[model samples]
Target: MSQPTDSSAWPPPAPRTPRHARRRKLRRAALTLVAAMAPWLAGSWGASRSSTCTPRTAHADPSFWEQVTQEPEEAARLERYQAEMQRGHQQASLVLGEGRQRDVEPLPPLQRRQLTQEARRAFQRAARIRPTVAEPHYYLAVFTFFALHSCAQCQFDPAIATEIVEELEAFEALSPLDPRLTSLLGDRAILYTRLSGHATPAKTREYLERAIADYRAIIARSAGLRQRWELTYGNLAEALMMIGDLEEAIATYRLAQRHASTASILLGLAVAMDRDERGVEARTLIRELGPDAVASWEEDVLRGDTFYVPQGEVHYYRALIAETRGDINGAIAAYRQFEQSNAHPQFAPRAAANRAALTRAVTRAVR
Candidate 1:
């Protein structure tokens, strides 16, 4: 019961045992500590967590895995959904075109509707897979619009109005706050433009304003987008014109033309200039495009010419010039004649709107 009084402490505590024994004892203690921590460490950072969290690797960066790691599972699910959507789209195109609409190569009504529904399913899956991504909601809105909200060469079903509205709301929620924070908003804007056709003034006005704001916001962030330059600006101009803001629309068209000297932008600029009471300037602008314009777009795609002449676009501009110069009847007739031969669905709505407006204006003028 007597405590050791010697400073050596009872022969140095038995020499800490043999060096080999000491090693074993130390190892045993170390193992015991590790065993105590094993479950906690495993639960927090196991093979499953590490293996499952493969970092996101962007096509632009081979080492973007770190960034993607923040949401690795979501990224994988998103990729799967995108691939599925792509597959569905390809299948839909092949089946609808080669099977039912082989005569014109355009989608038959039933086929188009079916494809849209299938696409909707894919997009819905995508939205679930990557709730953070905006593209899924955008696609959902698109498929809904195609299948339900619109019809011309393809008949639109009025029965799906509520569905379309629901999908659009979803898209809007997924949409960013500031002037279309992402390209998803751009897609949404285009979809809404179509919806704007039969919408009341209140609805149409709000949509047009949003579209214009989106375009301006996009222009402000010109650093990020380079591929869809012409399309974005051209669409913005169209949106502004729809709202009857000729000045802003013309400027936007010109701005877009500066970035990309496409015939469509030129045409839009001319129309806007004429509406702004600058018919001479508009004509000069059209003439400058020269044989760069075409008489008609043969490809059914109105994407601008690089070196080839933009004949159809020029003619459209010329007619716009006359209309801007108070020739309402002339513009209406020109649009009507062109509509009889034109096939692009994107253009039909605007062309029809212009035609209707011109007809009304003419009727009033005559009265």
Candidate 2:
């Protein structure tokens, strides 16, 4: 469940569009957004975690008969399950590609669907053989989210998304302190964040709230780990910003900066400050992060980083900054740039709308 963070409470630049119309636009944009991101997210899932299937340890005081009979049978079953899981995983790897080398062209849709269905059956069979084990459920969750349900041609099905979450929850129940749990939670959070784009206003708020909660859980669980979780911190901040919790978002972004002063983090902090009515500070931060620096980071740093801002958000923020400073022409140019780039689905509509409004204003001034 999500806390109440009504986005409507934030000031709008123009008169609010009718709710239904806005929702319709968002639903369409969300589909495009998910399609663009799903392949890479699926690739990341395959690379991040290994199967959590360990063989049962030997019985400490088993009889000779038990060792000869029951133990052998159990070992055979385990072996069968592992083999089935391996086959399914290989199928998945073929579709999702290997590690960070995700530039592999996608399999044709029909072939991909056929392979994924076969993989799903393999995982399902493995689960049936070892219903108590968590590994099969984890793989099933991954496949359901990334392969089966998240195809570029598929519509966003809320029920399927809920089922995927349930599968992940089953895995969590079976393996509470699993090393991969944090990454899985992050994945779930990302799913929720994307789902919010296609959801109704109420559902959007609820999804964002859940995302915020999951991100917080990840940060808590990752305490004392050798590597810093700056990305999680930044993600959490962004979720907070979405929910209109500007104060907490600003605080969280600053905390992320302490670990890593990334361009995304700085830009997020500036946006939060601007939304919270600290425009002077926001402008200072943007000015310090000059256009040249932003371009360099966009070209170099963001491509290598897993948790950087979406591709066009930098331009969107620039548009916002320009609008605040009364540079209408500059704002329009920035918005146009953002529209041409791989903008986030949720922000894309807003940018288009704002650009339209500014264009009208400029036209009126000319008259």
Candidate 3:
């Protein structure tokens, strides 16, 4: 789906381990690297697009639908929407429960009020054609999870969660168990992981485990599907890292690296290396990812930077190297560089601090 550009994945320096700053940088670096690699992990959209295949961006957001209403060129989106609407059947969704049993219901209402509406309408439309199809159900579950994470005042909606789970349970009863379930389950696990919020890392790990199972099953079923299943390797790596399983995360990343090597994968490797406390090895990736990976946009996301690649992550990463060489200015400069490219709204404070600290340092030096 075409999104509002990419989010920066720069690592941050947390307060807990400021003294073990090297470890802090690398640990955070691993996560940043994994997040940065997601776009590539999803695989390029080039081959994915076919004559019938419409863009995923417009469909990614409801705005695309509204755009078609205004601008005629968005006819493709309208056509796709209409077609999907026409297929209002359960089977039309293709599968109700693709990967996991994460059919949780009732989401935080205020958080994703708009998205909930979209999901309900889309799911209802699809259910009209193939009430049996899992696509709509899976998507609805995904939407609910996303809504669950919104900043709006909300808590776990156990009932809605139960409803979605029952839907998936019914799906399991009617649908034959096979590799097809892997894809559906994988999606469900990802959704659950996203919605789990501050839940124990154990829960997140469990969700990822389900996702990983689906990915691995897909790989095992047919050799023809290896490329697609392999893509989940990065996702698995990210999940493992998030749970603080650095050892398993490294292994998972290496496995993915063996399948394909690109800037994204290399970035993953760099992150893994940072996690493993192998700063020297991590550098190899940073060099390859280049100084600026984000596409240019007008926004000064981090500082006055024109793009965002989650590069503030890079600052926390390179901080190790700067510290290792006893170069305070260089370390601070790297942090500032990351701050300039920060895009995520969540990390604004730290980014600002880095920018301000560096600015004051520069000013004092001139004095």
Best by lDDT: 2
Q: What range of 10 consecutive residues in model 3 has the weakest lDDT sum?
A: 1-10
Score candidate 3 by TM-score against the native. 0.42
Q: Model 1 misses residue 111 by how many Å? A: 9.4
User: Once superposed on the true structure, which residue ranges of model 2 sit more than 4 Å away at CA?
Assistant: 1-90, 93-113, 128-132, 143-164, 297-316, 323-326, 332-367
* Residues 153-217, model 2: lDDT tens digits: 55557677776787888888898887667766876887687667666778878988988989889
Best by TM-score: 2
- Residue ranges of candidate 1 with Cα displaced over 4 Å: 1-139, 142-168, 171-181, 220-222, 296-318, 321-367
**TM-score, prediction 2:** 0.57
Compared with the true structure, all predictions reach lDDT values of 0.55, 0.69, 0.48
Clashes of each: 10, 0, 38
Mind giving the per-residue lDDT tens digits that candidate 3 earns over 1-367? 0012111111121112123444444455556556655565454474375566544431234553354343433233334444554343222122222212356454344433554455456655654445655554544443443343221343445455544544554555556463345545544444444434423546545655655565565556545654543356765665565455768878877887787754444555565566566656776565555444422111233332221123344455455345334466786777666556552233345545644655676689899
Prediction RMSDs, each to the true structure: 23.0, 22.2, 27.0
| TM-score of every candidate | 0.46, 0.57, 0.42
- Candidate numbers, best TM-score first, in rank order: 2, 1, 3
